[model samples]
Target: MTVVIETRDLGKTYRETVALADVTLSLEKDTIYGLLGRNGAGKSTLMSIITAQNFASTGEVRVFGEDPYENAAVLGRMCFVRESQKYPDDFKPGQAFAAARMFFPNWDQDLADDLVKAFLLPMNRRIKKLSRGQLSAVGVIIGLAARAEITFFDEPYLGLDAVARQIFYDRLLEDYAEHPRTIVLSSHLIDEVANLLEHVIVLDQGRVLIDASADDLRGRAVTVVGDASAVSGFTSGREVLHTESLGRVTSATVLGTIDAAERDRLTAAGLDIAPVSLQQLVVRLTQKEEVR
Candidate 1:
């Protein structure tokens, strides 16, 4: 696979405020990437810069081996879906779909039509007259139907109900299986998207904090539960992220690869070993970054 996008020492500033800094990163072709971070952590800013919606104060960005700044070749193959998708006040859902069809090279009217019915969106109604959930459906429909080679979804499930959100996930997976493309999803719904993402890039305080395969990140930490003394002895020199105790029993979440030998030793000490969720790992990692 080829590198779909790359950034070198990317930095952005607004007067005295730094929105992004020293952020060198790469995204590969035909992969699902989660741009996870807290608010004001540069997820949106980075996306804006890459899509040429904003400029960087320093560094460079390349999309499909060329600059994306007002470049029609690059922009035409990219689709950016966000909660705040805007249109003229008098524009209707039908008009929005028409415009997307004309703009995107790989637009799929069949898929768009199916999505419209699936989401129960009103075609003739003005976009401004639609409910929040209905409005989100319009963006989701365009994002999926456009079939852009590089798709960026920034919190696209804003007002969707549980069922509607699941529908979006199911459709995305179904379509992606048939048409592989590079996708960057910036979202705060960590645990929900953990299973969908093939790679993870965690940002903190306007810098890259964690970048690794989802499987590797899953194994980066482990939780151990056992007697307080035994747990203490086992984790004596390790980095303990979080700990809890009740009477003589204690549970500790620690960072590092717990090997087979260590697992056996933990079992021998009557300790239970468990896998750490991606959400928990991200939370701990960001908290640690804050402390530093």
Candidate 2:
């Protein structure tokens, strides 16, 4: 796959507060990447720097092998849908769509029209008067319809109900399949978008915590549940991410792969092995004091 975005030792700081620290990664063409972490984890900051919306304090960012800062050619190929996108006070949803149509070269008006109906967004209503969900629908519609070579969705599901959120996800996947493009989705609802991600990049405390394929990450940890004493004994030498106990029963989530032989050993010890979901794994990994 061709590399669409690359960052080398990227660092961003606001006064004494560090937003991103020595972050280095590459995003490939036609791939769906999940930019995941807790609030204030620098997910948005990194995206902002890559999209040239903000300046980096140190290091470099390359979008399509060129600096994105003030570069119209590179910037035009990328679309960023911010969580709280502001529009003109008098502009309506239709006007917003019109502006987006002129900006994004690949913008699809037909798809935008379909999304407006699906999201039940009022075209003529002033954007400021629209409900929070409706406002988010406007951004989702633009993000999906823009079809830029590389698109970034920064918390695009905010204020959207479960049903509406599902619609966004469905439409995004459908359009992506028909027209493959590089997409970076920053979302707090990890499990909700886990299936859509081909690659996963996790940030914690302004640093890269995890960067790996979704498949590899899925098997990076396992939960052992059984009698407290047995579970403790089995997980004694392993890296325990999290642990829970209910009277004599305990569940310990540990890092590392469990082979067939190890599984047999665990079962013989009367311990139940459970697979950890992506959400659980990320939460546990980020909660750790030292993940490096």
Candidate 3:
């Protein structure tokens, strides 16, 4: 796999606040990455630094194996759709599309037009006058239509309803299948975008917490449910993420995979096993006092 973007011990600070700390990771080409984290987890900070919109306080960032800051060749191959992307007061959705078409070498006007129609965006309305959902649509359209070699979508679904968000996801997958590129999606709605991620990079407290393939991360944890005593006995010596008890019944979520033999043992002990979803695992892992 080709590493399109690489960062080494990246650190960012503003006075006393540290936005990112000693973060290092690689983004492979043609893969969809889910940048999952809480509101202040440094997801946007990391993307901003990589895109050269913001500078790192310490460490290095390389795009296409070269510094991205002020590098037109590298910057031109990337697109950043920010949650609060700014636009000219007088510019309309159509004008924004036109501007993007000229700036991105791989811009697809047909796709942009289709997306405009799909989202029911008003072409001639001033951007400042558009609804929040409409504003989000404009960003989503440009990001997908640009088809940049590396695209960063930092919470691009803001203000979008469930149906509209689904539309964005569906169209993204369809276009991606035809024109493959690196996509980094930063979102608090982890489960909604979980299926679209080939790889997952989770940040917490301005540091890298988990970096792994989505498939591998999926099997990294499991939930066991049954009688409180049985579940507690089985979870002994394991890393338990969370546990809840209702009377004599208990459900315990724990880290680590269960082999066939373990499964049989759990069944024999009258315990029920359940698969943990990506969102559940992330929530548990990032919680301050959950792991035990």
TM-scores, all models, native as reference: 0.96, 0.97, 0.98
For candidate 1, the per-residue lDDT at 249 reads: 97
By lDDT, is 1 or 3 better?
Answer: 3
Query: Which regions of candidate 3 are displaced past 4 Å?
Result: 288-292
Candidate 2 lDDT, tens digit per residue, 122-167? 9889999999999999999999999999999998678899999999
* Residue-by-residue lDDT tens digits, candidate 3, 1-292: 9999999999999999999999999999999999988888899999999999999999999999999999999999999999899999999999998999999999999999899899999987999999999999999999999999999999978779999999999999999999999999998898899999999999998999999999999899999999999998988999889999999999999999999998999999999999999999999999943342
Clash pairs, candidate 3, are none
Off by over 4 Å in 1: none
lDDT of 3 at 175: 95
Predict model 3's lDDT versus the native.
0.94
Q: Using lDDT as the measure, name the better of candidate 1 and candidate 2.
A: 2
As a whole number from 0 to 100, the lDDT of residue 86 in candidate 1 is 89
Give RMSD to native, each candidate. 1.3, 1.2, 1.2
Candidate 1 residues 1-292, lDDT tens each?
Answer: 7998999999999999999999999999999999999999999999999999999999999999999999999999899998798888899988999999999989999999999998999998999999999999999999999999999999978678888988988999999999999988888888888889999999998999999999899899999999999999988999988898999999999999988998999999899999999999999888887777
After the best TM-score superposition of candidate 3, give how far the Cα of residue 211 lies from its true spot, in angstroms.
0.5
